[model samples]
Target: MPRETPMDQPLISPAQRAVADAFERMFELSRAQPAPDLAARLDRLSRLRALVQDNESRFEAAISADFGHRSQVETAIAETLFVLVEIKHATKHLKKWMAPRRVATALQFMPAKNRLIPQPLGVVGIISPWNYPLQLTLAPAIGALAAGNRVMIKPSELVPRFSALLQELIAAKFDAGEITVTGIEDEIAKSFASLPFDHLIFTGSTRIGRLVAEAAGRNLTPLTLELGGKSPVIIDRSADLDEAAARVAYAKLLNAGQTCIAPDYVLLPEGKVQEFADKLDGRMRGMYGTNPDNSDYTSIVSDRHYARLEALAADAAAKGAKIVQLAKPDDPAWKAKRKFPPTLVVGATPDMTIMQEEIFGPLLPIVGCKDAGEALSWINRHDRPLALYWFGKDAAARDEVLARTVSGGVTINDCLFHFTQVNQPMGGIGASGTGAYHGEWGFNNLSKLKPVFYRSPFNRLADLYPPYGTKIARLQKMLRFMS
Candidate 1:
């Protein structure tokens, strides 16, 4: 057999080799300059802010193309403007977030002081999903850069136009070793996840999240997963039915209910199920009009997703479930545009497919609950959700729900607003995800909080050396007694 040279090694393909080389280069750069000053970090953030501000229209158009008919207003509010707010928040608080914190010293080390210094964790890898592509990709990158870490982002290939635009923008603005974006195929995505990164963050479906977790585990890499699940909303008896219905309609219809934190189901007071459904139906029609094709309603991402949603609704209807569709069933425009109308599924039981899975579409199941206690009990029976929403005026019921159920975050009297608070952390717990991010929480998660102990240069403890004398024993006895 012919000898194989180092350059001709066949362990990995050319594309994989290129990715490996990029990660290596970035890692080396991070080691050489571990700590970046506040000004430098601010400069990077400023550039990102400018990128969004300068090309707002381009982003709106690209994302609209990816989603068939994603609204310009929705794109601006949810993606471009949202990311700008994140950058501004990080820039405003970067100095305080980067400062070393003082900790109290113990009695055993009276003359010493303890401090916690936050340091960069080298290269960070982020795998963002297709839904809200720009926000998910850049939001986490904001934290990684704010923490003085190099970032390599792998955006979903499903949104090719947006991904290409993002790749172009990033490549033009940043050095490859500092910040880079990759839009590779499935096999390459797996290779990207398996890289030995200092940390990794993934935002997508629970199934894909599990795969990413397993790959990261092989390298023992720390991860922050923002997986989706059946996030429920409780509409208490005291809630203003009209107002709650309006807010829920707006939230569940945004991006056609393609958000991870979008309310997956609603628990209403048993007897008022019909009343609540009527209000929701009216509100959805008012917001988006009777024809989804003529309104700003976004289509399902692809035919496969549309088929899945159709099948779920069909299965529910076949199982004797009542479906309240807001649009005309005979409309051919919806079929051609791949737009599924806002649907409300009532009498949804545990055995139905719609109730079993996370409905990342415009399908909401209205589950009846006897009271607040029944609602809380039902929530506890399932996996922890990314978010929870409570709508009502009863402070006691709200407090009870907050204290009893566990979720990544909560928004009272509204939906999807908790995720916009830059000061608070946004992440999932248990099946939904792990590790929180956003604002200082994001900075802390990406950085290593190393503790330092500064000891005074004195010989007061010389008598306590390992001489095993009676005097030493007496000193030890005195210390123990004092403690």
Candidate 2:
């Protein structure tokens, strides 16, 4: 090859350039207007509400198209409704959340008041996953906007149709610098995390979360990783078998078990495994039906995910565990539609593949434990989960689990309900993920709560200032007396 000039070399891909331009534009605007007033923030929230409300039907259709077939009811309940609720909560409390609060000063600093002021962090970047695209993407944006910060979102490439629609909608509602959504290009995904955002929030698997964290670390960008792990459901002895089975079945089957907080496995009293498994299978079938074309059922995101779930089932089956699938896995109808059957892996052990990883599908493993202590030990032995569910009437057993093991959050008798509480924080701990955001927790996390102290000129504390004389001796004596 002949020697090439610097002009011959491509500096950046088109995707990277586009992302950089967007970031720089928003960063500049944020710098120019550091704090947005309550009215301005309210306007942004209102537009966001209008955007989703006006085109609910269109968004539902686009998301369904993207997923091959996402349930319309599920989309409405989980995605759009969740975002609207977050927006409503933030709007109602925006004025109060924006106000500076008074802080008490120490006795020595009397007449000097301290105030904690909440101000916007410049630019916030959100990297949302495809599982619940709309909710995960816009919920964080609501908080950042409520906190008066500019936002840029990078939606998952897996749902291109939905992502494109979201980008178009956002662009139409607000300026690119005010709130923007980027394309789902490979180059953009790689470079998006490298941008030095004032704060970045990522929602996805632990494997990808590590890479994102590494890239963000290079820019020292503060991150909130909403990652998933093998969260467990503990069926206490006092739990009503029928009630527990129904709740677990609904939770694990919703969105076809693509939820981050979905119950990955179950730990019930030893002898009750087979009975609970049977009940769970019945419940799953009753809710979604047996056919692949059931309207209430959701399809897997892709062929690869479908095959992975199959492999997990196969591995568990080959290792002496029994597989109870709601629909025949080999049926052409199921595979053709990309809908993996809801499965139960009974007699699952730690060595089984299904038990080793976070099954982001409809496959749920049921493992038996001797007692409550063994159940707690089993959970504590693994990585801390993002959410834990304990079903029972025994307060002691529930309290024991709560006090012993550490997880992101817990639901006493159900699943995923803790995440719906607007006042409670939603986040993970340890390997599951880190940091939290939801309602006020989100507002405070995304905002800079600066502490301001006003010094009083009238204070005579200066009397102890530099003159080493009888005054210093008197001060020493006074200090000794106080001590």
Candidate 3:
């Protein structure tokens, strides 16, 4: 890490100087013309979605490269499906979501009726993270386009291949004036944040989310920061270890555990820690095979991430933590690949390096707590996470866990599935993140709710406006009564 840290960097960057200016010029020209008829906007969005659907395979290929062997079927079923599903749902409901909503008029404003119009914010900037890049970008774009605003997508540079491929795919379908995807250097991320946008949506690390918010603050731009925290998966003693392990492993292996909503770590019942670890190890190896690489399992993003995960794993091992090997690391399964095989740490404690950091890799850290209550307390001791998962048949136990532990979203008897619920808002709380977006919640976040008040020619209270006196006192009395 650079010693100069945060202040060492400059916020104004090449992307800001070149790509942003180009998009701004294009947006200006597009806005100067009459708004695309609502029908035309729909047509454009349709074309955009169709283009994505056409090149869906190509996007999967890029994501595969980013993951060093991400399953194409998984990509299609997960990432591509999310994008298309969101777009399809948005298209089906665009008219209804766009319809202006009316409100009941209070007797105080006798002649006035109320309307809440969803107006498109002029331009929206989306900064997507490396995990599930396609879904993040496409989901936000649907809202911007639906609300009649142009979009500039800044995909994570960590996944360069996917980022470049997305730029090319988007450029092939849309003009810079309508939507643009830019491949920017990592250094330019701060500058991207500095751009003046009506709304900005960022999904990434919590530390960087703060910096993005500050840069946006300079321009008073509203933002939706989707950051991450130590998302905990609690497995109660009363739960089925077999089913829990299978589902948790699925979530942990998805994108090689690179999802923002991926299970960060687990809290097991005391004394059951080793037993749970044993079962988890069996399931992971049984599902993925003895060799992780050749077993259709994916690897870490890059050598940097691999090394970081490796170091954390090594530190835990050196600190007397017992390593439960799910998939052997040295098996022919290891082809000098960046693959970090599924590993579990037993006898692990909060003081270990693996427990201290956000393990965004295939390693699972098991923390033993006396009970669900202890697990909930441990969770509360840290930053609130983006999501939490619980597995148990005990209804009261589950309810106690749910009622005590706060998270962006909760999944009962599952992991990372809360994010699959499309209709609800998805985001973090406190240090994890602020604001959320999914389905119509995303559309509303990207649009400006311009409240409209229409005053009729009849029963107008002109005196309440300026020449206030006894009339104001009488109006106040009526307001109190109405309240």
Which candidate leads in lDDT?
2
Clashing pairs in 3: none
Spell out the clash pairs found in candidate 2. none
lDDT of 1 by residue, 300-368 (tens): 788888888889899999998899997633367786787888999997888999988999999999989
lDDT values for all models = 0.89, 0.91, 0.80
Tell me the tens digit of each residue's lDDT in model 3 across 130-172.
8778887788788778778888888887788888988887788
Model 3 lDDT on a 0 to 1 scale: 0.80
Clashes of each: 0, 0, 0
Per-residue error (Å), model 1, residue 200: 0.4
Score residue 405 of candidate 1 by CA lDDT: 91
In candidate 3, position 383 carries an lDDT of 88
Clashes of 1: 0
Each model's TM-score, in the order given? Answer: 0.95, 0.96, 0.92
